[model samples]
Target: MFPGSETRAGRLLVRARRQGVLLSRAFGGPEPGEALFARAPKPWMRLLPHFLALAASASLLPTTVVVLLGDYGLPGVLAGLLGVGQAAPLLLAGARPLSAWYVVFSTDVLTALALLLWGGPLDGAAWPWPAPTIVGYLLLCLPLSLHLARRTLVAVWLSTAAAAVLVGLLRPGHSPGSSVLLVVLSGVVLLLGGALRERSEAQRRLAEQETISEAERSHRRLLEERARIARELHDVVAHHMSVISVQADSAPYRVQGVPEAARAEFTSIADTARQSLAEMRRLLGVLRSEGTEAEGGGAGPELAPQPGLGELGTLVESAVRAGVAARLTVTGEPAGLPRAVTLNAYRIVQEALANVVRHAPGAEAAVTVALSADGSALRVEVVNGPPATPARPLEWHGTGHGLIGMRERTRLLGGTLDTGPTAEGGFRVAAVLPRNEPAPGENA
Candidate 1:
């Protein structure tokens, strides 16, 4: 080759590579070269390998170049070019690291062979690797330890040792002790690599287990919270319910000169109140006993799944039996609603129907359950038409808490409620609860 031809040739190759990149981009297709870039090692672990390679290449390349320039002149510059070539493997360590080592191993063996054929027979400390070989293998192995699987790293470690030994025993200048040292140092590189791989794997497993444990703890906390709410409110509400039942039962018996029709109406009120109290007691008992029941594994009876709108039929029948003619109509597919939405819907309807009986006895009430088209929310409307034939009802005075309870239930479910007298002198209670909303003030 001519003077400066090697540098010129290197520039030509680089220019060709860049031109190819432009053509690929212009034509609009994936670049194979980007495959190397895409798989680069993550940031924290990447910089060290490349920096070590840079230091090694800078140190060894100049020495090789000066020595060869004096001996082989232009040809010696080619040998120096090979020395500078160690940078390729170092830079590639952030991406295709193991590939770089394979290249380094082959190049060192070839460099040692070239020393025999062209640089003269092995005669000094520089026979096998010289400066470039030592740095190439050592720096390249650092990333291999971090990224490569254990079995692959072991194979590389063994092959590196064998190649060094073979180069020393076959070629003449190097002693047995130097070959042994090379093997020892190469094995240490691999051991460090394996240690890094194992530590990273262990950390990943620990993270996954911690996530699962946290989810389980969250679920348990929710159940305990619901139980706490049940324990606090059960007795207070139950007392009011019991009083309502007692009054509804004894009022007609105590009053003088009442018609058979009036007595039947009083009987209906007592029956409806008793049924509601029984159901509520069972539900609250489930909550109150949750802590003991879970611990003792049979300390109390198991309750059915929580009430939802599916129980609306039973509610409508109970309302009818209580002298208020009631029926249920569902609009939209319903598909289903969230558990909290369903439970609150049932409660809201129960309260509204009870109001129909209390405020407008013998009124015709229609309960409509309309799930929104998007299934994101549900609209419940309980409209009771005016009572049949105006008459004086039993001086009806009861706790003012019924409407308050309805509002509270609606608010906790993150829903809307509108209750007032209709234009036709009937009462209407309407609510719209969004699906899967967090229960206000407690777990849903």
Candidate 2:
């Protein structure tokens, strides 16, 4: 009936299912003392198991049918059950691998026992080392190596070896040599599986380290930006405050109507401003601890006597020479005012004039500083027409920081600023500040 042909085919089918091409995806293990076991497996690796399962089902099912057709004198039911059992483990390996291994092992041992009890049923070669036995052992070993832990693999391998030895010793004709071979096969499968596990673990660690490094870089950038803002604040707000302090300190002798008490009051404002300036400098120094000047460079920009409302004429003259038909006019009784108000008025005019030169080249402009009749507030306005030669506006783009600086300055000093294009095809920036703010420690 050509029964050996069917039996040999079944043996090969089972061996292919266990410790076959799918399990031997990478044949060699890592060299001793190598850094882990290389990298991750390919993305298509999961598909390999399903392929093996398909091939195993095809081969194992046919072998069973052939054996049944031959009518090996075994019970028809037993022959059918044996075929189903052999294929079941290979099919089950996809989802429930460990259970599949146990099924393969149990079915192999029981089939051998059943054949022995039936008194040489089917005339197959050995008791347990038959075609089904080899196939079932391999099916268990391949997937077992994949899913089990290192220690678990070791335990399973040892257990399988012990079972093989026991089967050989207990069975009359089974040899110790086949049992030894089975144990060696189990060890080889486990070594392959351990190497893959190490590779997967190493990849996970590398991904984690990349995430941490990115977070640290983002935090470093945030700190650098904050330091830059501190330097700008020191330049704009602190500079003006210092000028106010100096002006108030010397106003008594410079002016005729100031009383001794008013002089002392001015002295107090100057002392307070100086102390504030010192604290601000210390804060700036701390922010700049990252490096020298840390982006703003040294001592801010130097100027002649900290120019303010007093230098409005010089600023206008500079604007006129730059080709803007410029005018500066002072209105109302121009008395001494808070140093902050004076500095802000001068800067507002300066930035507005600069914008006209840049965005509205060849434009007419006017600068006006008007003190209120009651001397409670001061208003500064600069207005410029749109570029006469629209084809070529000045292109040396400023840092885009001029207007932001102006707004920040007005906001900190408790002032209101309005700026935008005017209905006359021109631009206007108007700011008003309280000329007589309450003295330090005085209620607003």
Any idea what lDDT model 1 has?
Answer: 0.61
Q: What is the TM-score of each candidate against the true structure?
A: 0.51, 0.50
State the lDDT of candidate 1 residue by residue for 1-444, as single tens digits.
011122233345446554444333332211223322232234433254456556766766676566544543336656766666654556666557767777777877777667656774344455566654675577677767766677888898889778877777775545665556667877898797678556645654454455455446545555654554454344434555677778778888789888889888888988888898789878866676434544455434333245566678898888788876677877775544545566667777876766566555545434343434235777888777776655445325433334555666677667788876678766667887777633223222
What is the C-alpha local distance difference test score of candidate 2? 0.61
lDDT for each residue of candidate 2 in 275-385, tens digit (9 for 90 to 100): 999999888777874345324553533312345677878888898898877787777654556555666677677777776666566564343333342366677676665
lDDT at position 365, candidate 2: 36
TM-score of 2: 0.50
lDDT scores for all predictions?
A: 0.61, 0.61
lDDT of 1 at 371: 32
